[model samples]
Structures are given as structure tokens and as C-alpha cells.
Target: MRVLVIGTSGYVGSAVAQRLSAAGHQVVALIRPDRGKRARRYEWRIGDLTDPDSLTAAVTGDIDAVIHAGTPTGDATVDATAVAALTSRLRGTGRTFVYTSGVWVLGATGTATADENSPVNPIPIVGCRPDIESQVLDFAGVGIRTAVIRPGIVHGHGGGIPALLVDLARKHGAPVVVANASVRWPMVHVDDLAALFGVVIEQAPAGTIWHGVSENAVPVRELAIAAGQAAGVGGEPQVWPLSQAQAELGASFADALALDQSVSGHAARDRLGWRTEHPDAVPDLREGSYR
Candidate 1:
């Protein structure tokens, strides 16, 4: 399949593009002009998602599918505008469009594990996503094969959400959390999540929703210990009051971090045979690249 992957320079995008290429797909990376010196590995197309013209041009010509993994810049309008533009271009095109959402959209699931059918109660930062996801899914009825992927906390290679804890561990000799230490975070390896993109692009039907989570849930305190140990801190995790966390990391992110969630990816595993090779995230965070 000929695939167009946006956000090629980002952590998730780079991994997804590489995995698709390794899987023998003709991967075209849509990169920003400022991040020059294009990678020679895949066919590179320069464009910005926020720019309607660039998004239209990027979707034009011949392309089998598009993976919209690019992240928002904290401005919901910019993200919504991009989705509107992309949906407009792909409407009635009979092409595959994979949109990236996150498990945070399910909000605090408490003890219950969220599934594909779970209701979305997004946090403040991603509050705009439910509406945008609806808009993208609407294209499925208009001849576009649209799929929404809700990934859990993506952790690997000492990057992603774990990096925040690791950085704090290095600075303060312990990992930190907001308000409560028992909040649960669902996690997925970057490589495993990338593989799901390949499966959905090739086999998913229109309006499919896939959760790219491996571990159903892990406590913030446990992750903090792992992060601190990996960073050579090896101490009890520190707690930040919600107000302090909000002041430091912004209310949206702080509230998101405090959410207790457990999510299942059984649909992806059963439907597409996605088996996570790196499921034990604590060990990885403590001894692997993050160490």
C-alpha cells in the first residue's frame, strides 16, 4: 500500500513511518519545511497540517491511505481546522484515513476498563477531539474508510510521557505525580502502536475504532519508582498538589495526569491479531533505553 504519514518528525510518527516502510509499504512522510534535510529513507512531502492548501495538496494526486498522527499545538482551533480540511479533501475519495486520538478521551474510567464502545469524557486539553473524531468518522459514510486510533500513554526509547517522569527524577531524585499517587495510566509500546497502524490501514472497515494499548493499567506510584530507579534516584515518588501541578504543567495536562484509567485493546488484538512484543513497561523503563 502507498501510505502518507504526517508528523514524520515526531516520536510516534517517526516510529510509525519506519514500521510501515519495513513492512514493505510505500510510505510517504509529510514533514514541515522548517525541519529540513529530509530523510532519504521514504518519499518525503513538505507540508503543514494547519495550512488548508498544504493539507489539500498533500492528500491529492495518488495515495492509498493517510495516517493523521500529527499532534495539536494546544490550540483546539488549529487541530479542528486541520481535521476539517483533511476530511473535506478525502470526502467521497474512497481512501483510508486514520486519525489518532488518545485514551485520555475516555477520561477517568476508575476500576472499569474502557473498550471501543466506551463513552468519551475527554480532559480539557483534548476536549475538542470527540467532536473532531465524530467529524472524521462521518466521512466513512461518504465513501472514505475512516478509522480512529486511541493510543494509551506511548512509552519507549526513553521518550514520550515516561520522559517527563524521568526528567523530573533526574532533577529531584524522585518521580513526581499530581494530587494522588494511585492514578492509573494505560501504556503501549511505540513499536506495537505503529504495527496497529499497519493493520488498520490494510484491514480495518470504515468507521472502525481501535485502542492501541498493551498494559491495561499501571499505577503512577509504580511508574514513578521505575523512573526514579532508572534515573538513579531510587527513592519514594514525590507528590504535587493539584493546584501546584496545574500551575506548573497547566490545568489540562495536570488534570489528565491525575485521571485514573484502565483501557483494553482486545478489539485490535482479536480483530487484527496485534500482539504486543514489549508488554512489561516497568522493566523497560527501569533497564531499557529509558535507563
Candidate 2:
């Protein structure tokens, strides 16, 4: 398969690129010219989706699958515009287009071990989700294999939000966790998430919605303590109201930190034969090592 990965140089895209290439697929990474020289064995195409010509060049035929991982900033409408352009061009091509959405779109609901069918709680940022997923899924209706992957808080090695928190812990000497870290956030390993992307593109039903999560949910406080331990920082988590978290970390990031979102990965496992290698998300944080 000739896979053209949009935004293929970032964290998740890079991981997915490695996964597909290791599986014996030829990978074409569509990256910004700024990523400098390309890595070995992979083909590189310099382009930005903001420009139609560049985007077309990125996805021109001979591309068998597309991992739509690029998220343009500045406007929600612009994000939709980017997705619409790619889906419009790729419709009926029999190519698989994988769209990455976050589990945050399910919003805040008491954990019922929600799966792909959970009701969505709309945050301002995630409001674009339904529209975006709908557009991609519509491609399946037009004969393209379109799949949407709703990823949880992914962590592994230098990736994951927890590791990023470790960076913050190192800088601030102690991390301030919102509401005592008990707010459940779903999480997965970066490689596991990338593997699920491979599964979806290859096996998921055309209109299926997949989840890239391993554990059902881990408490935020537990996650915080682990990050602190990994960073060799020590301090009891500072409990604060949601308002305080918003004030401390910008409100958008605060919503993520404070959201008690638990999502189920059962559907992906059952339907796509996607199994997560890492069953636990806290061991690395708990012991200060990802090994």
C-alpha cells in the first residue's frame, strides 16, 4: 500500500508512519518544509494543506490510504475546510481515510465505561467533532473507506499528557493537579494508539468509529502522582476548584485536565482485532520509567 500521511512528522503521525512502514507498506510523509531533511527509507513530500495545490500534491492518486492527522489552528471552520477538501478529493477512490478525533467529544458523563456509542458532551473545541466525523463517514457512503478514531489521553515515553506534566513538574518543582487528580481521564500508549490506526485503516468497517484507548480510565490524581514520581518531584497534589484550574492553566487545557472522561476500547478490539500491548498507563508514572 502507498500510504500518504498528512502531518506525518508530529507525535502521533510519526508513530503511525513507523507502524505502517514496519508492516511493509510504502510510506509517504507529507510534512512542512521546516522539518528539515527527511528520515531514511520513507518518502517525503513538502506541503501544507492550507494551500490547495500543496494538499492535492500530498494526496494525489497512487496513495492507497491517508491518515488525516493535520489540525490547522486559527479557526474551527478552517479545520472543517481542511477535512472537507481532502474528503471531497478522495471520495470514491476506495482509499482508506483515517480521521483522528479525541474521546473528549463524548463530553463529561459519569463513567459507564462508555464505548464508541457514548453520548457526546460538547466543549467549545470539540463542537467541530460531529461535523468533522460526519464529513469523513460520508465518504464511506461515496465508496471510500472512512474511519474515525477517537483517541484518549495518549502517553508513552516522551509522548502523552502525563509526560508533559512531568516536564511541568520538573520546571515548577511541584505539579498543581486540578481537583485532586481523581477526575477520571481515559489514556493509551502512543504505540498502541498508532497500532489501532493501522487496524482501522486495514480492517475497520467503512463507517465505523474506533477508539484508541487501552485502559478504561485512570484517576487524574493517580496520574499526577506518577508524573511527580517520575520527575523526582514531591508534593501532595494541590486541590483547587475548576475555576482555579482554569486560572492556573488556560481554560481550554483546564477542561482537559479536569474532565472526568472514561471511554471503552472494547469495540475496536472486537471489531478491528486491535489489542493494546500496554494494559497499564500508570506504571511509567509510578516508577519514573516507561520501561
Candidate 3:
């Protein structure tokens, strides 16, 4: 399959592009014209998610599938328009269209673990995602093999949110946990999430939704301690007041970090045999990647 992947230079998309290429799919990276060339492993197409004409131009010519792992342009209308532009070209072609979403859509799952079947209560950071997800899934009815993957807080490869924790530890002389110590996060390694993308792009039925999580819930305090270890500041993590964190990281993003969620990815594992390689993120935070 000739797969056109957006956001190929990003942490998640880079890993996804590599996995797809390793799986013998011809990977075409849709990059913004300003970003110039990327790794030669992918065939590059000049495009931008905010530009419909660029997106339309990039989706043409023997492309078998599209995986949109790009960062949102922060405008709901633009994001929806981009999806329309991409899927419109693939309509009636039966080509795959995978949209990247996040677990935050199933907000604050407290005790009961949320799954793919759970109702969405999105936080402000991703308030518009559910609607865009619906737009993408609706394409399945028009002969496009459209699917949505909602990944958990991504960590690994010395990057992502965990790295931010390490950076915070270094900056403050202690690791920081937003809100309270009980906040938990669902997580997935970048590579593992990428492999799931490979599987979904090839085998998932139209309109399917997959949760790309591995660890159902990891306590943020535990992660902070590990991050402290990585930062050479081995001590108890400091709990930042929500107000303080909100002042720094903004309310929506800080609230998202403080949210407690236990999200299950068992659907992908049970149905698609999408096993995760890096199940435990603690070691990755302490001595593996972030270290």
C-alpha cells in the first residue's frame, strides 16, 4: 500500500511512518512547504493541513491510504475543512483515512475505565475533536475506509510529555505533578502507537475506532518521581497547585494534565492483535529514554 502520512516529522508520525515503511508500505510524507525535506526514507509531498488546496494536491495520484497524525491547526473549522479536503479526494475510492485523536475526549474517567465504547466528555483542549471524529467516521459511508485512533498521553524516545516532566524537574529542582498526586494518565509508547496505526490502516473495517493506549492508568506522582530520577533530582515530586499550573500552562492544558483517566486499549489488542512492546513507562522515564 502506498500510504500518505501527514505530520511525518512529528514524534508520533515519524514513528508511524517508519513502522509503515518497515511493514513494506510505500510511505509518502505530506510536509508543509516551509518545512522543506525530511528523511529520505519517505517519498515527500508538499502540503499543509491548514491549506485545503495543498492537502488536495498531496492526496492524489495512486495514494492507497492516508494517516492524519498532524497537530491540529487550533481552529476547529480549519481542521474540519482539512479533513473534508483529504477525504473528499478519497471518496468512493475505498482508500483508508485514519484520523488521530486523543484520550482526553473521554474526560476525567475517575474510577471506571473508559474504552472505545465510552461516551465522550471532552475537555476544553480537545472540545472540538469529537465533532471532527464524527466527520471522519462519516466518510466510511461514502466508500472511504475511515477510522479514528484516540491515543493516550504519548511518551518515549526521550520525547513527549514525560520529557516535559524531566524538564520541569530540572528547572525547579524537583519533579512537578499538576493538581494532586492521584491524577492518573493513560500512556502509550510512540513506537507501539505507530504500529497500531499500521495495523488500522491496513486491516480495520470502515468507521472503526481504536484506543491506542497500553497502560490503562499510571499515577502522575509515580511518573514525577521517575522524572525526578531522570533529572538527577532524586526526591519526592512537588505538587503544583492547579491555579499555579494553570497560570503557567494555561487552564485547558493544565486541566488536561491533572485529569484522572483509566482508558483501555483492549479493543485494539483483542480484535487486531495489536500488542504493545513498551508496556511499562516508568523505566522509560527513569533510566531509558528521558534519562
Candidate 4:
């Protein structure tokens, strides 16, 4: 398969690109002009998701699949626009389009575990995703193989959110955790999530959703403690008031941190035989990849 991977230079997209290429698929990476120098065996096409012409160039007929791992910023509409554009380009191509969503869309799962069929109560930060998810899933009605991957907190290899937590732990005696100590958040290793992307593009049926979670959930305080320990600080976390966190990191990010969620990716595991290589996120945070 010839796969065009959006956000190739980003944390998740880079791993997706590498995984696809290693699996013997022809990879086309859509990256910014400044990042083009890092392009190697996989073809690199200079483009931005917000630019229509660039999107057109990147989504050519030769591409068999699209793994959209791009993260949306404050401009919530950009992602929806990009998805619309990609949808138009892929309309009747019978190609696979795997869009990345997040578990935050499910919001605080509380005591229950959310599956693919879980009702969404997205946080204010990712409030715009449900519409986009609906749009992408609707592509199947047009004869396109589209799947939405809702990943948990993506962490691994000293990058993603864990890195930020580690930095915070190093600077302060303990890391700052949004909300109270009991709030739980779902998490996934980057490598494992990337592998699931590969599985979805390769075998998942159209109009479906998959959660990229390895461990079901981890408490925020526990995660902060692991981060603190990793950064040579004691395993104690300072609670950041929601208002304060929102003021500092914006409402969306802070709200995301405050969500208490537990989710299952058992559908992917049972349906596709998806095996998670790294199941324990805390050990990874303390001494494995994050260190």
C-alpha cells in the first residue's frame, strides 16, 4: 500500500510513517518545507493541512491510505477543514483513511469503561471532534474505507505529554496535576499506538472507531508521581486548580487534564489481534522510554 502520512514530522506521525515504511508499504510524508531536509527513503511532499493545494498534492490517486496524525491547535476549525478536504479528495477512491481522534472525546468515563460504542461527552478543548469524527465516518457511505482512532494520552520515548510532566516535576518539587488526585486518564505508548494505526489501515472495516489505549486508565496523581520519580523528585504532586491551570495552559488543555476516564481497546485486540508491547505506562514513565 502507498500511504500518505500527514504530520510526518510530529511525534505520532513520525512513528506512523516509520512503521508503515518498515512494513514494506510505500510511505509519502506530508511535511512542512522547513522539515523537508529530514526526508529519506519515503517520499516527502511539502504541505500543510490548512493549505488546499498542498492537501491536493499530497492526496493524489497513487496513495492507497492516509494516516492523519496531525494535532489541532487553538484553531479548532482547521482540523475539520482538513478532514473535509481530505474527504473530498478521497470520495470515491475506495482508499483507507484513518483519522486520529482522542479518548477525551469520551470525556470522564468515571467508573465505567468506554468502548467504541461509548457515548461522547467531549471536554471543551476537544469539543469540536465529534463533528469531525462523524464527517470521517460518513465517508464510508461514499464507498471509502474510513476508521477513526481515538488515542489516549500518547506517551513514550521521552516525548509527548509525559515529557512535559517530567520537565514540570524537575522544575517543581512535584509535578502539577490538574483537578484532584482521584481523576484518571487513559494512556497509550507511542509505539503501540502507531502499530494500531498500521493495523487499522490494513484490516479494520470502514465506518468504525478504535481506541488506541493500551492500559485502561491511570490516576492523575499516580502519573504525576511517576513523572516526579523519573525526574529525581519524590512521588508527590501538587494539585493545580482548574481555573489556574486553564489560565496558564488554556481551557482545552487544562480541561483535558482534569477529565477522569477509563477506556478499553479490546475491540481492536479481539478484532485485529492487536497486541500491546508496552502495557504498563507507569514503569515506562519512571524508567523505560520517558527517562
* Best-fitting candidate, scored by lDDT: 3
TM-score for every candidate vs. truth?
0.95, 0.92, 0.97, 0.94
The CA lDDT at 165 in model 2 is: 71
Candidate 2, clashing residue pairs?
A: 106-121, 181-220, 181-221
- Give the TM-score comparing model 1 with the true structure, all chains together: 0.95
Question: Where does candidate 4 have its weakest 10-residue lDDT segment?
Answer: 33-42
lDDT per residue as tens, model 1, 1-291: 889898877899999999999999998888777878655678888788768778778776588899999977666788878877766677778889999989998989987999989999988878888988888788899989999999999999888988888887898777777789989899999999999999999899999889999999988898888988888888778997899888988888888889899999999999888888974678878888798
- When 2 and 4 are scored with lDDT, the better candidate is 4
Q: Give the per-residue lDDT digits (tens) of candidate 4, residues 1-291.
A: 999888777899998888888888898877776674773767877778777667776788888988888867546587777887766778887899989989989988878999999899988888888998998999999988999999999888788887877887887777768778788878899989989999999899999999999889888787888898888898568987899878977877878878888999899999998889964778888788776
Best by TM-score: 3
Worst 10 residues of 1 by lDDT: 32-41
Off by over 4 Å in 1: 37-39
Give the alpha-carbon lDDT of every model. 0.87, 0.77, 0.92, 0.84
What tens-digit string does per-residue lDDT give for candidate 3 at 32-133?
888767566678999888789989988885999999999999899999999999888899989899999999999999779999999999999999999999
Candidate 2 residues 1-291, lDDT tens each? 888888666778888889898888899888776677747458978776666566666787888888887665536677677777666667777788888888888888684788888777767667778777888888888988899998888887666577767776676677557754678888888889889988887788898898888887888777776777778887876565778767867788777777787788888888778988864777867663432
lDDT of 2 at 213: 80
Model 2: CA > 4 A from native:
34-41, 288-291
lDDT of 1: 0.87
Candidate 2, after superposition: displacement of residue 246 in Å? Answer: 2.5
Estimate candidate 3's alpha-carbon lDDT, on a 0 to 1 scale. 0.92
State residue 50's C-alpha deviation in candidate 3, in Å: 1.7
